[model samples]
Target: MKKRILVVDDEEGLRLLYKEELEDEGWDVELAASGEESLDKLEKDSIDLVLLDIKMPGMDGVEVLRRVKEKWKDLPVILCTAYPHYKHDFGTWASDAYITKSSDLTELKQTIRDILGKKP
Candidate 1:
């Protein structure tokens, strides 16, 4: 089965872009515009991994990550954010990988493969 990836980001453009890019790399991409939606999807879907963003209006990514870790301890989560400083935050330590947002997506894809134990 194809790996299912849940992308949680407040920006619509980024979500769409990631969905398209990840889909091209043979992943089933699911998008959630907010932390609440992300949690909902996690409950309803068999997601293999999560690409999470910080600095949202409602619930921040760190809080969402905490909730996810509480419920789904084995699920791998990758923090993909514009702010690199969040890497220093203790809350982000629970995540499987932390990546800075970039248009190139090369690093992000590599991280995903590494965490999933798949060859690129």
Candidate 2:
């Protein structure tokens, strides 16, 4: 079965771009505009992985990552952000991987494949 990936980001354009990009690569993509919504989706959907953005309006990605890990220990989350400094924050260590946002998704897609143990 195709893996289900939840793409969480406040920016509508970025969210849509990721959905389209990842979907084209054979992933079943779901979108969440906020941390709260992402948590709700996690409860309702059988999500295989999460591509989470760090900066948001309300509950930030770090808090969301904390809660996600607390509830789903085995769920793989990749911290996708513009700021690479968060990688130094201990809170981000709980995530399976950390990726800085880029126009080219090669690294992002490769990271996802690596975390999911899928062949290139």
Candidate 3:
């Protein structure tokens, strides 16, 4: 089965871009405009992974990452941000991986592979 990924970002353009990009790569992608919306989606459906963007209008990625780890320890969440400080924050939250918003698609895909590696 194709993996389902939830893409969370407040920017409409970026969210749509991700939905299109990841979908083209054969991932079943869902989008949420904010962390609250992302959490709502999570409550309604199961997602294999999360492509989360930091610096939203509210409920920043760090808070969402913390909550995701708290409620769903096994879920893999890759945080994308345009800030340098988030890398440090991600380490503290035990995030699966942290990618700068300018990150190359190849690296993002590789991180996903690494996280999803050997999973039954």
Candidate 4:
């Protein structure tokens, strides 16, 4: 079965964009507009990886990542943010990996593949 990925972001356009990109890379993609929506999806289905946006209105990605790691210790979460390290330490949030929002699409793809242990 193809690996399933959950792309979570408050911006509808970004969510759609990432979903399309991941789909093109042969991933089974799902989009969530908020942490609450993502939590709901987690309850209903299994996901292999999460492309999580750090900044959000309710329940930010850090909190969401914490929750995911708390309940499902092995769940792989890849954080995406435009913030500097001093603003928000994506690494401290217990994510498997991170790529700045400004990062190249190729970099993000490579990061995901590396974290998933697929030959990159």
Candidate 5:
């Protein structure tokens, strides 16, 4: 089966862009506009990985990562954000990988493949 990735971002444009880009990579993609929505999707779906944005309005990606790690310890989450500083934050340590946002998505796509490749 194709790997299903849940992308959580507050920005509609980014979410759509990621959906299109990730879909082109041949993986199933799901979108969530907020942390709560992402969490809800997680409960309802079988997601192989998460591509999360860190600067959301309500519950930021860090908190979402925390909750996801707490409940689904084996879930692979990649923290994708414009703010590179968060890569150093201890809160992001639990994530499977972290990639700074870029117009090029090469890094993001590769990271996703790397993480998924390691999973059963």
Candidate 6:
């Protein structure tokens, strides 16, 4: 079965870009514009992984990460953020991987593969 990835980000362009890029890598991609919307999607979808953004309007990615970990402890979540400072924050420690956003998704893709590879 193809892996399904839920990408939660407020930026429309970044969401579309990630969807396109990840799709090309043969993974199913789902998008959510806000933390609230992502949570709603999570309840309805069978997501194999989540690529989450830190800075958002409401709830933010940190809160979402906490909630996801609480409910689905084994699900792999990669914190993809523009802000590098969040890496030092304790809130981000729960994520399976922490990656800074970039036009080049090589690192992100590799991280996803590495994390997913460990999953049964």
Candidate lDDT (C-alpha), each: 0.92, 0.94, 0.84, 0.84, 0.94, 0.94
Global fold similarity of model 3 (TM-score): 0.90
Off by over 4 Å in 1: 118-120
- Which residue runs of candidate 2 sit more than 4 Å off their true CA positions? 118-120
TM-score of 4: 0.90
Summed over model 4, clashes come to 0
Worst 10 residues of 3 by lDDT: 84-93
Kindly list the per-residue Cα lDDT of model 6 for residues 1-120, writing each as its tens digit: 998999999999999999999999989999999999999999999999999999999889999999999999999999988889898999999999999888888999999988887788
Query: Residue 112's C-alpha lDDT in candidate 1?
Result: 88
Candidate 4 off by > 4 Å: 86-91, 118-120
Query: Model 4: per-residue lDDT, tens digit, 1-120?
Result: 888899999999898889889889888999999999998998899888889988899998888988889888888888888865813565445887777787369988888777766622
Number of clashes recorded per candidate: 0, 0, 0, 0, 0, 0
- How large an RMSD does model 5 have? 0.8
For all the candidates, what are their Cα RMSDs to the real structure?
Answer: 1.9, 1.8, 1.7, 2.5, 0.8, 0.7
Candidate 5 residue runs with Cα over 4 Å from true position? none
Better of 1 and 2 by lDDT: 2
lDDT of 2 by residue, 87-116 (tens): 899999999999999999999999998887
TM-score of each: 0.95, 0.96, 0.90, 0.90, 0.97, 0.97
70-118 per-residue lDDT for model 1 (tens digits): 9999999999888899999998999999999888899999898887775
Which window of ten consecutive residues has the lowest lDDT sum in model 1? 111-120
Q: Judged by lDDT against the true structure, how good is candidate 6?
A: 0.94
